[model samples]
Target: MKVGLIGFGKTGKAVATAILDNNELCLEWVLRKRTLLEHRSVPEFLGIQSDEPGLIYSSLTTSMEELLDKHPVDAIIDFSSDQGIYTYGEIAAKRGITIISAVSHYGEQEREFLKELAKQTVVFWSPNITLGVNYLLIASKFLKKIAPWVDIQIVEEHFREKAGVSGTAIKIAKVLDLEESDINSVRAGGIEGRHEVIFGFPYQTVRLIHESISREAFGNGVIFVAQNLAGKEKGLYNFESLLLPYFYN
Candidate 1:
């Protein structure tokens, strides 16, 4: 399947490389800022060579307009801006292109729009795409029951430039009926990513933690979703839905 990548950041580059590792997936186009495209191909920024002989710079683009019938793709795996979701989501719905977005942080109205778009095309939205984090999310459901009276708090740390709470932490808080105040975001030096779910009682605490060793973990999860995204019905999906086939029927 040909994929139109939406970002060229750390996760984006990692995912692009990981997708290329699969024999079935290849990059058709990448949406980057025009400023970044001033001189060289995104591959130069990413430091990876394209498998196609002459398609390196030709495939890099600054607009989704490049994703046309002349250069179509089966699906689009996006890990770009929160704004990119609406931009590509609308076009993909009309064109019947499947979208798997790893971005969170959209307005309520924007989310409503995406939900409507889902009825037109398949849309998978997840904050964090790591299998380990999904496992933690799955555990939250059971953990909620096991300790309904316990207090829930999410503490996460990311690189200094990352603002606000980790989307994974926010999702976990919501599932466990915790407030935003219970979620803490710490910005520090180049920590890959770390999430800790703390369940506290009178005198004890249980911390369920998942620390990413590198960006490759998230990239692996993106490839897994992309590989499985084919032929899915038009609707909204999450990480749990992606895992449903294996965990259930």
Candidate 2:
């Protein structure tokens, strides 16, 4: 499948590299905020040997409509900011392009915008797009269903530079019907990302933990979503809904 990437920051570069390495996915172009390294081959910049025209474009220089008109893609994997969707969502939806966004947070306005976009095309959004983290969430939810009396606590650890609580932790809390204040946030030195759900039972304690060793986990997640979302009807999808089928069979 042909894929366009939004955002070329540290995480974006990792995701682009993962796409370039995958034989089944083509990295079409990447849109970033700055003009630095504009129009450069993504593979060349990353020191990968591939012929796919993984070009880099600056949002300032190239309009989203111009880019989509010139080079249409089957899907767009966004690791950009929450506001990034305003730039390309409607244009891509009009053409029926799939959108997979991993933006960490979105306000009510963004959520409503995504709902409208879903009416036109397939849209999948996740705060934590790493497969393992999502799996942990699913498993935790399952455990909660079976044992409603268990005491569950969410703890999220991230790099010290990150401000506020982890969005993923908040998502977990929301899913489990816990308050935001119940989440425990730990900031440490250079930790990629870690989330643990502690389940305290009468007899023993169980823990489900997902540690993101690197940003490439996000790439793996979008690829998984893109492959599965290929022929689905227009709708908004969350990662857990897509994963639930796997647990059954």
**What overall lDDT goes with each candidate model?**
0.75, 0.92
Per-candidate count of clashing residue pairs (backbone under 3 Å): 0, 0
Cα error, residue 115 of model 2, in Å, equals: 0.7
What digit string (tens of lDDT, one per residue) describes model 2 on residues 20-113?
8898899999999899999999999999999899999999999998998888899998888989999999999999999999999999999999
What's the C-alpha lDDT at position 211 in model 1?
A: 95
How well does candidate 1 score on lDDT at residue 149? Answer: 89
Q: Model 2: clashing residue pairs?
A: none
63, model 1: CA deviation in Å? Answer: 4.7
Tens-place lDDT digits, model 1, residues 1-249: 777777777777777777656676777666655445543454555666666311222223434655455567778777777777766678788898888888767678767877998999988888888889988887776777987888888899999998777888888888888888998889999988898988887798788899999777877887788777777888998888878678776
In order, what is each prediction's RMSD in angstroms? 2.9, 0.8
Off by over 4 Å in 2: none
Could you say which candidate leads in TM-score?
A: 2
Global lDDT of model 2: 0.92
